[model samples]
Target: MSNGVIVRRGRYYWHLSVQALYDGKTACIDWRSLLPLNGGTTKQRQSLLASSKGLLIALVESPRDHRGERLAHSTVLNWVHDLRRLIRWMTSKDVWSFSDLRVTDIVDYMTFSTMRKDGGGEVAPHTLYMRGKLLHEMWEVRHQYPSPLLIDSTHWILKRRDDGDAVRRGGHLTSQLLFPCSVPR
Candidate 1:
């Protein structure tokens, strides 16, 4: 199927099935299949969920970045996962809109995520990098959404060191050492 979000049963469920740019196979996603929203009133939670779903729809429909190149299917899936994390974090803090998100909140989230335990350890460095990149891309595609993120995320730059470590600065995870083997030089 072409890249787009499909709403079914009067908005109770949404689905997306698109051709993967990397492999040219159908990639199917069921929107209602994600984890349930937590830590907010029903109305607030639903509003945020709706907005996020809209963002996902917009992203899938237009997969091109600033360079007019298509994004890989895996990249889009990663964004979907990252967006869920972002939404959960936002709702936890009572932040309902992207416009309401502050840089410090983002910083706090980055710190919180680093400390988040998965399989008895902190999240991987490459995972953090991907999350940071998602924030940048969210800003890049803000104009495509109905309610857009107002903050400028261009300053959140990711750079590779002389070693095979990826680091972000200027409003992102600052100086958080990444595993050398996880990132490419």
Candidate 2:
């Protein structure tokens, strides 16, 4: 498993395509052009999943944000947590690799996370929504949208359900604080 993009050589496809370094020069070859010479067979399906190293590796390796400045530790930690949770859940389902994950798995996780903390009660909508958002962020490499590490391109378009995400807990909740005179004292 690699971390760049899909590369198909003849008929085999590679999920990650490393850059080339030769003659003291690194050529920017199209990742798709640099595919596996073996024409990916069942033996290579295991390789279909992105490397098991986890998104943390890609995050740490990215190091900088869009501005080329270092990302905050908290941001990094959030990414790590998301990746850890996803990996743990995936492993439990016998999915040992990231690419092995199907869109259904994510849908299932999202549905499960929204379940009530108790038996029949629901957590705050924000809690549920945020988890989906955070999980979505883990797919990226170098802050790229839709991530470079997916086996199914359709997953890039996947979105969480919008029903529970109302504007409940933002600053607007303090309408009175913004206008003290409006208080019905």
Candidate 3:
């Protein structure tokens, strides 16, 4: 089948295709419609869009899980959502390329994700944990991305503090050392 063509198996179409059958009707999700890519400059936007597409496609093609099972289509879609948020945040911080990201930026992103959208309160602990875990998964597959993150995300830690708040350590910090409580907002 062609790149954008929907692959059908009886009434259902493959979820990885650009189009799928829903309720016996065709539903299209064009490749260009995937990422918002709204906040960056033209060059940055192009680069990000290309890189993001490459990463998603790579993940779809490879079973990087420990059990070597293909990721569920919903999981890949959730990663797309997470990537959109991360890309927007990175653009705001003048980080166009994943390779340009630093450990401090990663820490800042972790902190930024904890807040409620309406400024009411922090997000649920599980929500924060899931987001962090997703990020770790992406980091593990960084090399598969066309533009990979250079920072060693494995060195950093995402753990709950004694007070039950999420804590992120810098890549340079060891498990015995804690980041100072005053992480810049």
Candidate 4:
């Protein structure tokens, strides 16, 4: 099943739509229009549409029951912008779908974002980490429910880290670090 959004040719404007079949009924999504094919790069426009589709799916699978309806129009538009940026970044690295992501992919994306930029500054590690976390969260929600295909382990480790541990060991648990003044009086 092609989960990514598909480009549809419309009469007046190119309609970006995603068709999800649930219980033998089709859920059709028609996102707001793109500039009449005149202003943006073809790749940019297509990525924009695809990202919109991804967000629609994300909203449905969002932790919040009514994320889509709760967001204001301008906020929704801004989300589209953020989604487009994410898609473009992913596209540059040949990551076009959520399935393309892996543990290594998360590390690589963080590295890419944190590298010194042409503009002379690197993005903060915290920023890169935040983006990775958000993307991972989206992947988590999307896979929690059943899909057309049986979800594999990539989807199962949603709450767990790359390893199976609920709490990462080898921290300062055994140390007197928290009670600093208690050391060797």
Comparing 1 with 4 on TM-score, the higher-scoring candidate is 1
lDDT of 2 by residue, 1-185 (tens): 13233233223222233334323432221223222333444443344233423344455455443544433334544444455555555555656545455666665665666666476876565555556655554554524422233533223333334432343543211110011232121
Instruction: Report lDDT per candidate.
Output: 0.60, 0.43, 0.60, 0.42
The residue-by-residue lDDT of candidate 4 on 1-185, one tens digit each, is 13223244343332233333323443222344332324446665565455445544464335444354333333334444444445556556665454555555544554455554475686544444444445544555564432211123222222222332423753321111011232221
lDDT of 1 by residue, 24-128 (tens): 555545455443544656776666667777677666666564543444456566777788778767766778788787766666676666655454667766676
The TM-score values for the models, in the order shown, are 0.65, 0.43, 0.65, 0.41
Residue-wise lDDT of candidate 3 within 1-185, one digit each (tens)?
Answer: 22323244222123443324333554333444433546667887678767776666555655554643434445656666677678778877878887788777878787888886689898776566656766666677787787777665533446533332323332221121124455433
Off by over 4 Å in 4: 1-52, 60-69, 73-75, 115-118, 124-126, 144-185
- What lDDT is reached at residue 134 by model 3? 61
